[model samples]
Target: MSIVKIVEQALKDGYLTSAMEAEVGRICNAASELSIEEYMALDRLMGALLTGEVVVLPRKQFINVMEELVLAEAIAKVAEIEATSEQNLDVGDIAAYALNRLPPLYATTEEGANFQRARAKEELQEFISKQVKEAIAQSLNKPEFFPERQALGTSSKEEVISQVSNLLQAYAPEFEPQNDQGTSSS
Candidate 1:
């Protein structure tokens, strides 16, 4: 909810675009809000509903929400930097609040640091990385994956227009952009 508030305000105050706000909201909606412990437990939970623990399947929605959460942090970091002065930056407060509320990563060091890097944290990171990599691998096969394949490096107007024209021909054959004549047709 705080993320939603931040994005909405950012757009209203002209600091963020409406499209960017919507994008953040969309990603946030897909994420699951679990403390570190809860998330770890889900991996070991059995029968899709582990005993005494809530086993959450990665739902279609969580992905979007997770994306939003990621974007919100990035946007917040940017805002913190542009805050005009130290008095305007609420970044530290927000970060501290989130970290404080997060479940204490199971076995911590005697010094109270979660830096037992040899522990569950590594496994968790690996699991998450695998999940993301798999998602991208699947997306690569999608027909719309590279809709503007040649748009990656076009610098001049002619080159960019040519790339757009190719994409339009493949994706929107029914409609013709007025710039069709402007192309060299080579």
Candidate 2:
């Protein structure tokens, strides 16, 4: 959605989601310049946020204990391999692979998280280790396909600007820039 649309939605709902905030940030960062409408929308959002008219939701209120366990195991194993050799492993990839194969232990409170962590260590350490090892092996054996692919939460500047421009055109067609011929640029 365009910044105006997102702001309108947030105003209507009285809540600004983390995703919405991130999208706005991404668009603002990507754009070389913001339109007058975009600036007004952002200003309104800021005022609403400051006055408590809109609440920004927290990105995550719970934690998965299994992810921490798998990450710790993966880092230790990857460190061992990297220490003795020149090979470097993607710890995030390894952890994600293992996490997908394991059950989640979610906790909303610190005490709950501690209990979940202890329970996992006592009952699932071996399984977590095995999964991490398998993930490492698979990563090692996997060929380097799509080597140019960007990592998560990233995009080319041109791509981001194009997306923002398209959104602006769709929501407010009159905002499009005109050439000397008095026609909008494509």
Candidate 3:
């Protein structure tokens, strides 16, 4: 079954919420080689993520189910950092260290670094927001799933304004890329 289908079933099974299903859908689209066959693990993992349930899967199966294509160790580290952060470490420190030791996705940009504190939880929010936006954008590709009301969800002026504000806060890129390092196109 497709990840979406699996997620929907899992949601019905009391594993996850509709909102979380929507979020995972984005992550699924972001990945490279992940296929529909292994979504059961994702449904389980996401439930774990949202509820702070510790999950241990067979090594290969864990990697196959994760959305970012994160390796077993990396997933372990994100989980570890998240766990340790409350007592002795911050996510930036962990992520910075991770950047050096791990691959690009965890390290790519420090866009989420400063917000990694337990109280603020910025990095997690950033990750979720990005996934949400990406999922919504990609859903547009399927007319059946991305019906007009569902796709935009902006039938009123106030809703539109709120949506735009929320999107800008969460998903809007910071700069349009420097044309010549000193100058901007805008």
Candidate 4:
């Protein structure tokens, strides 16, 4: 079978990778007897395949091929920037391409955006935890809430303070205090 047919079949089966595409193009080019019309026709076929209408769960082999293809392209972009005499390489375009070529797991823009949001949430949680710890430490020395605590039980100040800290930690696991050695009290 011709390289074009192989590419078409691989694409239809959802197993085509960028590396395979480039290799197939090279093979097609080597066949000098192919007319301009033939090349253009192949281009059209490839273009149709990229229309995003066809969604399939890609095979593991294809997934591996895609990772290598994207990584190589990203590395090449970095190398090109390094080789250029101009120092102010924006690199934004390459970064965008690399991000767009991420795995099938991040197939849509929403998936990528959601992943970023999750990372931001984790960072926000950490920041809030630090703030809560500081607030708890300062409040530990205060007597403002001691009157209310006495009405509940015969607990001493130390016990009351520990209980308050525990309650705070229960509400926010990230706020769980560190021990003397700076590890979590878990």
- Candidate number that wins on lDDT, 2 or 3: 2
- Per residue, candidate 4 scores C-alpha lDDT tens digits across 1-186 of 566565466657755655566766787778868867657656655665677533333533211222222333333444455587353222223333443434322223434444543453345434333433333334334556434534244346456446534543443333333366856677
| lDDT of each residue in 1-186, candidate 3, tens digit only | 456565555555655555555666777787776755556567566775577553222222111111121122233444454476553222222233333332232222334422222222223434543443343334323445433442245565456446534543443334232364646688
> How high is each candidate's TM-score?
0.18, 0.64, 0.20, 0.24
Candidate 4 residue runs with Cα over 4 Å from true position = 35-41, 53-186
**Between candidates 1 and 4, the lDDT winner:** 4
**Cα distance off (Å), candidate 1, residue 186:** 53
Count of backbone clashes for each model?
A: 13, 0, 0, 0
Give each prediction's root-mean-square deviation over alpha carbons.
Answer: 25.9, 18.7, 20.4, 25.0
lDDT for each residue of candidate 2 in 1-186, tens digit (9 for 90 to 100): 889999999999999999999999999999999999999999999999999999999877676778667765786788899899998777667878999999999987777877887798789989999999999999999998977866454466456436434544443333333376956588
Candidate-wise lDDT, in order:
0.38, 0.80, 0.41, 0.45
**lDDT of candidate 1 over 1-186, digit per residue (tens):** 344443344434534444544554565577667445434433333222334332232322111122222223423443554565443222223333333333334322233222332242344444433443343333333456544544347645466446545644543333322244644333
Q: Give the TM-score of candidate 2.
A: 0.64
Q: TM-score of model 1 relative to the true fold?
A: 0.18
Comparing candidate 2 with candidate 3, which one achieves the higher TM-score?
A: 2
**Sort by TM-score, best first: what order?**
2, 4, 3, 1
Highest lDDT model number? 2
Arranged by lDDT with the best first, the candidates are: 2, 4, 3, 1
How large an RMSD does model 4 have?
25.0
